[model samples]
Target chain A: MIPVLEAPPRAPSLDIDCELAAAWLVAFLRDEMIERRNVRRAVVGLSGGVDSAVTAYLCARALGAENVTCVRMPYRTSSTDSLDDARAVTEALGCVERTIEIAGAVDGYLVNEPDADGRRRGNVMARTRMIVLFDQSAKLGALPIGTGNKTERLMGYFTWHADDSPPLNPIGDLFKTQVWALARHLGVPERIVAKAPSADLEANQTDENDLGITYLEADRILSLMLAGYADAKIAARGFAPADVALVRGKVDGTHWKRHLPTTAMLSNTAINEFYLRPVDF
Target chain B: MKLAIVQAKPRKGDVEANFAALGEVFAQLASEERPYDAIVLPEAALTGYFLEGGVYELAFETEALAARIAALWRAAPGASRAPVDVVVGFFENAGGTFYNAALYLEIAEASHRIVHVHRKMFLPTYGVFDEERFLSRGRHLAAFDTRFGRMAMLICEDAWHAIMPTLAAIKGARVLVVPSASPGRGFAAGGELESVAHWRNVLQSYAVEHGMFVIYAGLAGFEGGKGMTGSSALIDPFGDTVARLPALGAAVLRAEIDFSEIDVARARLPLLGDLGSVLPDLLFDDDLMPENVRRGGERPVTP
Candidate 1:
């Protein structure tokens, strides 16, 4: 009989300070809004999950609560508890709130394709939510803030160009564990912080269950890999070989999603080559 | 010896505010059980470097500024517990002339001593730097004795010249402290900043050539839309980066430097011994040109 492999023992702590992380993100968001984006207002899609909740809180702190607009976009299959958690965050942050139902737009696309799989429906839902968020951003004169964390982004857990289409992201550099740490430091609700992370795209869908890996183990492996550790060395550190192979495959497969669109170079002076200016400038 | 290198973003034209921020970092360090022999800060850490119109107003008198830093050090909880030296950079106003300077302060029990001050010799005046327009150049370069060893100080541009570190080595300095306010520029294919790679190369070359520990402490944050690359690092005599801080934000990095590595490196490769023979031939020569070459006339072509 084959034995089941368990994850390696967790590291004691990540190398981060919640207080400093919170302060830096707030300052970065403020600078991005006032200095770079030239917009006084910011709009964030607040899911019940920790990522969006923390992002909304940071936006509220960076820009004033009056200038931040929190949007809760839920599909028909989205859980009721997720909406309640989103409302809890908006009320706690004292920001303007809007609820945009994405069920009609998503189902309208899925109606013709009755045999569509779960992945297709999930992509449609994510794209529909993005459309609503962007349209609301134009109406409110606010820039859309991204809520994707580094862990999910690295593992290709998010729909490319759909959930990853925002112009700016505050927590993009932070891992999932770091996000929870910063969320607690920023006074996010304990219930929201403790809740299992989910996309709420389909019924009874949890991130860990879908990915078949807990965030704690995934973050530890990802950090080591990103720090230039080889796969053999990572597996020698007590991580299961299957887990390491899975992570390496995901990261390698998602390489195209993380970069800008490839442009064919026709001349010496390309668009992004010769003519370049900093985003802030 | 244990050392802490701080890469901080100074509020432009605000000296007191920058001091307060440094004071907070010191307080935080004090709470830790770790003991450091010295703390190194970036160039012009008190006042941002690119202040075009406010140079004179922000320059500090040596004694007055020393007293303020002494007060902050004495107030820190670790000052009484452990004797720690601080190396910081600031704009100096002496005899109505402004010069970029590095100050080394020794904080002992109940006393804050101003040990040495090394003004920057090379004031960069090219593209983004115009230090000569508002500041006077330093006239001398020397190494001083410290608790760690004989250490020398050099501001940003001074370290760029290979001759400056050579001079320090000639003066029996084993450690070189460089405080920099370099702006970030250029990008490579891997998306890493070119300035970071350039600075790493510069630091490694000096450390390997001199068999000395090189500390490159740089500033963080943006001023006038130009961001300072905060790749503050500690390099061993073997040219390996022992410790490094990230490139964008304010951070305090701590690492212990082993002085005994200098002896090991020097014994393995005696570059200094080779320099002893090479210096005289380069310095004492009266005529470096050929006899046929005249002062003002064109030289005859050799057949």
Candidate 2:
């Protein structure tokens, strides 16, 4: 039998405003607990980024910090800088925090083959972090929270096996720049928000560096172009033609990844197709 | 003690054009000296309904359009006092997605400021209205603070959900403004009431139960090829329909609502006080389960 794999989650198309981001977590939890009455607690992956920090803060406000947990899963190469920032958030907000190191588990899985390529090493780190998060979530009876911001998700930059859990996300709609703005609003440390972001799997890894453009430029271009503004109008916003082309290609080519897996003879509930439904999806 | 409704048909996909058209109407009203305590407009007044457009096709330039609409509010004032607060519909793009929006316009002397903008939260994906197809549903349910009494806004499907208006009133909103667009032909498809009465009944019940006034405004045009039939009305905190619009045509509903009546009605009726009463032994197995009731735990037995 072929193994069934859950696709990694993609970020939302819109660049969410900070107020909306905080409001969504606030509203979802409030309605669920007050209206639905099933919710008692919330759990999140605190990556020390602005997105996760703000989500964590909102979850605490929505569910009370006593009922919220912040899980920090750090890889061996993961910098102490981010870990400290994550701790600062938990401590400042009076939230519970736990640490699970994944370097040993990932290192044990890799044969090294005399010398492994960078891609293999990075996958090992990304997948292992997800494994750690899910394992703890199951043990604690908590939901795993997603940490990817919208820009990375739009470009299909997240690892599938690690980040996509059906009900585990609270920050998928915010863009990278908006994430920074939210982090400041939530009182996260400046160093965490100001530094160039990275996955910490390699010596020099940053989202913009890998995407070949910064989020501020990409979001402006994507937002404007998506709004049907002319290329000339978008370029006037300080983006190079190459940057625009690269982002446009990424958005177009990976559009399939944003959708569900397609197949012939699609049903109302086909894997990746949209159709009429008896109930709301 | 007089009220006025400003019902204008929205142009498809042109917010700037719609704003211009509204300016003309406001000018005409000013010239005629048609003074009103408050003016209510349709949902998505800025950008016409995007029931068909996907994320890539919708217009979300709310930042640019708000100033223009606010300028129109600046043009209209009540009787030289605190000025009228105009409650109109528009599309907002604060979160990188098009939202079905309602704006509260308050004219202070010569300047009209948008005090609150409410986004449509409950997106209807089924039937003729596929709002989930374009804009992001809102996360806020509380009403805005306006001179028209602590007023709040709800769009289309939001009135059906009790929490949106309930939270608004709890947050100090005395008046709830619901802007709706009901499909005409779909009203009775094969003798099934497709959300026509549901819209009116839900808002009316919520107003009476919560002791809050409900000002419902619906678009008077055929939206999304669905041929929208208008059924706008104002329901007081007593669950009685105070004023209903014409059975079928372009008409702005105006009514005199004294919010001071709410406290007296509630004090006399005291129906909402029973909200906290528990029927632990009786199980309500019905289509409607007040969201709070479904989260079941055995009620403590009192001796």
Candidate 3:
């Protein structure tokens, strides 16, 4: 239950019409997946988090429960509760569910790199899961659905090509706070919705703690910054200067991740670098 | 006069496929027992919008376009011999220069006539739109005579400016058809899409201010993740929406165009007449106009 505040410290400017957003996203999924890609089935990686759970629900709504295949891939150190939560989502949605233990696959590669840090191991596990998702999608003739949200995407918190690999994402443009609101509207499991967001890469790892800022504060600052607000103005609006700077740095540093690999433009007819054509074209 | 507005979703960079689909639409409408006097399609109905460098290949000459459309109408089954006025937008290639234009054609069973063509005057070059880079802007605006009544056409960005509608009204146009290809954006606060709401507000204001029937034809479908807003509508001269399509997907909306409503609105408001009387003097008055406008130059001078 949300605590009702007579007067909150600050109202967020990220409110969206959940009803309209749901309809639009559902249609978007159908358009891109069904009509454009000529596929009626979806393969989604369910991490027991709000983002993946919401994506599962939308996939079920768009392509029906029978056509949506939810894959839960857990590394050796992944929380068991996360597996249980992911199972609960499949059960609630009545969609097909599969479990693939990625411990062996990730560990087989890491055995050679004994001095690898947690970040490297985490990336390995993420890419291992992506491999399973793509293979499963090919086996079932289904398309993989993306679940990255705007907050994590803008902060560049996702695994480079692993977490953001899918060609279509229904919730990529929504902020994390807004995704929570959408989850509630879509009747997502309350346990998943209320839990602290995590990549579940290591023990006692939480997203807010790693970023040194809460999602609420990060979303507010990022929204303002994206609207062309100066850093000083954002700090003047009661956001901590350090917090604003941190968010700005992460966003500015991750510009390469959001775009395709740059191509050398030798002539005016170069692909994507000079000779531009729309994706649909 | 009864009008039919088609919110079409053209395949990107494929004119043949779009024309085939449009042919099906004409056949479907012509098969109806109650014939329509006119049909209005959205801008870039034959070639999808947002084609950065693909417009050159898709652009068609006016005569070729007419010939193709006439062939399609002639081939469509159950089409009546009575002429049907069609207003559809396309990418036009005149000699070597290309432009974003709309054509007013009277399609019949055996013959077709190109009534008038309105090239887009205001090419939006900001934000997601990069029209001015690819196509040349139009120079003139005029109202032409039709079988049903005197009508005028304005491409999407042209209607965004108030002067376009005012000039069309002054030229004795009782009906204004605006072919638009606007993408949906800004979902903060309002229950509706912000772009759709803004279009409704401006279209209604233009209708009421000029006392003419405004028919808006909007494009629907996604191109490179940019979804076109499909809230096509018909607003009467009294600022009332007679018919409207949904905010998503392709659809066809039919509404009766009662020319007498224009008379009622003009008699009640008479704002167009008042503006017309003073527009002549306002155009030539040196003090009232900006120095650059009076000099007919592109740039403004320093005071």
Candidate 4:
């Protein structure tokens, strides 16, 4: 739930009704948006970091501490730091927590598949985590609340349907770096925010390490690009040509992943138009 | 004209329950001898939204529901004298595809006609909204040539895109109706609701800039897993709230909006014509943003 920043609406002529934000947005999303729709409980995959930390906090806030549960499914290659962080976060958020060590689970799954690239292995771990989450969500009358931040979403840093596919995402728009900003705002533990971001599926595998360049750099580049600046202009904003090229390429490659599968329109009228009518009527 | 904006919670995934709730409200209004000019409801009223299905599955028993609703509307006080147009939100199945639609029925005819159907054009994928996953977005804008006046209605996200309302206004719409199931603020640490002044002001600005009356009907009460607060109301041509719902559920706020105010605003400002002349190429990125710079300027677009 992105706030209005207590600022005026962009259109001076239009009033944004931000008072409703203070009065309604969270309650609407928490009670009616999730619960009335049959999401009786919320299941979160806590990584112990600020993004997940904040997401967990918000889940507890929205669904109540009892209805909020966390699964810390660590792999064999996962870090002890992540486990500790996860525990700390769950404790702080005041939600129920469980640990389902996935080494045995992954071994069973990998028996049919090749080990392949370590990167692909991480994705496999991620997807495996989702399988557990969805199954639990169903069994417990809960909906998975995703913790992927805006930076991860924009770069396609997450496995498709893994860490995505939440009934509701509380922090999907804030960038990784901005996530830290919001974490501070939410009174998140500094130790969690101070550390580098990792998928925790392997050793020495931080997010920026996999992609190259820190979130601080990536967000800066992304913001410039979204602002509709020319590539050279974005480079002028203080990015190395190679850095800009890499991030831009990542965005372009990931763009299709973010949107619906496009259909070729040979006829004047399309059969399935997703956006054609007004909302309230 | 007496406009009644109904802000209430519709039972999620239960069309029969929702229609019954609406019927209860209508019956109550009918007994009060209160002649309402129009009864406006929240977006996608009958089909509690976000069902996991394709458009075909979303197809509702609108015809049967309409017949029952039309009867109650016709019998409603002042409906025949001045005429009451019951504007409702429902799932409309067209050629096996369902759309989020607004059905307007004139109580005098006892028939529910689609005077306007604003399919939400911009399916907000971000935030809590997942319109793209369920409902089909609208293609063409719908403006109603009603007994009340030339009017247009926009579905939730459609209001975010001024293009729909602008097209309707060009089609002679003097008033705009927006119905939304907007995610509202939750109970925070301080027990404080977040600020939504930005969006409320946006509506006011839309009304003022277009020199048209803007009526927003929001779904109130908790639905799904979240709670909702009703701020449903009207923004006159002068960008002032004429009437509004007081709480989150089952509120009926009424007001008399003057169309002459639109005419006066148009005569005074006339910003639309000037706004139309602004060229896309002339605008730059910094021309927008409207916040602390997230990043520096752009590099260049590589071919």
Top-TM-score candidate index:
3
lDDT of 2 at A212: 87
Candidate 3 C-alpha lDDT tens digits along A126-190: 89989999999999999999999999999999998999999889999899999999999999999
Runs in model 2 lying further than 4 Å from the true structure: A1-21, A32-37, A112-116, A166-168, A263-281, B1-214, B217-303
For B1-303, candidate 3 gives per-residue lDDT tens digits of: 878999998888888889989999989988998888899999999889988888888899999998888788777788788888888899999998999999999987678999999999999999889998889999999899999789899999899988899889999999999999999877774578888888999899999999999999999988777888989899999989898999789899998988999999999999998998888888887765675465545565569
Q: What is the lDDT of candidate 3?
A: 0.90
DockQ (model 3, Cα): 0.63
Poorest 10 consecutive residues by lDDT, candidate 2 chain B: B185-194
Q: What DockQ, on C-alphas, does every prediction get? A: 0.02, 0.01, 0.63, 0.11
Residue pair clashes in candidate 2 = A8-A160, A11-A153, A260-A272, B45-B89, B121-B138, B143-B152
The weakest ten consecutive residues by lDDT in model 3 chain B span: B292-301
Task: Please report the TM-score between candidate 1 and the true structure.
Answer: 0.56
Runs in model 4 deviating more than 4 A are A1-36, A107-117, A165-168, A226-230, A254-281, B8-14, B27-37, B42-44, B48-66, B72-84, B89-104, B108-213, B218-231, B243-252, B256-303
- Write candidate 4's Cα lDDT for B140-247 as tens digits: 776768887888888777887666666766667889888877755432223333423444777888888878898888876654444444578888887787776654
- The lDDT for every candidate, in the order shown, is 0.84, 0.67, 0.90, 0.70
Candidate 2 vs 4: which has more TM-score = 4
What's model 1's overall lDDT?
Answer: 0.84
> Weakest 10 consecutive residues, lDDT, candidate 4 chain A?
A9-18
Tens digits of per-residue lDDT, candidate 1, B104-189, equal 99877677788899999999998878788778999999899988889999999999888899999989999999999998754311
- C-alpha lDDT of residue A93 in model 1: 88
Tens digit of per-residue lDDT, candidate 2, span B1-303? 346565555645555676787877666555445466677776755445543443334455554555665567566433344476677776666757677778776766666666887888888887556677666888877656666568778887787878677677666677888877765432212232345557767888888877888888777543332334456788888888898774244576768888788997788776555543432223364433565354444444569
Error of 2 at A187 (Å): 1.4
Clashing pairs in 3: none
